[model samples]
Target: IDEFWDYDEADRLKAIEISHAYRKSRGRSRR
Candidate 1:
């Protein structure tokens, strides 16, 4: 159960990072 929890946490963080990167790219394009 602990391993699953860790996996989920990592996945969530990775998803957030990807979203952040995408947002930054879009903002840069506006310039």
Candidate 2:
């Protein structure tokens, strides 16, 4: 139970980090 929740949370955080990186790269490309 706890391990499952932790895994889910880590996945969510990883998604957010990926999106942030994607946006940053997009902005750089727009330059």
Candidate 3:
């Protein structure tokens, strides 16, 4: 259970980072 939760947390963080980078790139394109 602990290992599963750890993976979930890591994946969530990774997804958030990807989304942030994507948003930054998109914002530049709109400018």
lDDT by candidate, in order shown: 0.98, 0.99, 0.99
Cα lDDT tens digits for candidate 3, 1-31: 9999999999999999999999999999998
- Writing each residue's lDDT as its tens digit, candidate 2 over 1-31 gives 9999999999999999999999999999998
> Can you list the residue pairs that collide in candidate 3?
none
TM-score of each: 0.85, 0.88, 0.88
TM-score of structure candidate 2: 0.88
Ranking under lDDT, best-scoring first? 2, 3, 1
Question: Which pairs of residues clash in candidate 2, taking residues 3 or more apart in a chain or in different chains?
Answer: none
Best by TM-score: 3
What is candidate 2's CA lDDT for residue 10? 100
Candidate 1 minimal-lDDT segment of 10 residues: 22-31
Candidate that beats the other on TM-score, 1 or 2, i.e. the better one = 2
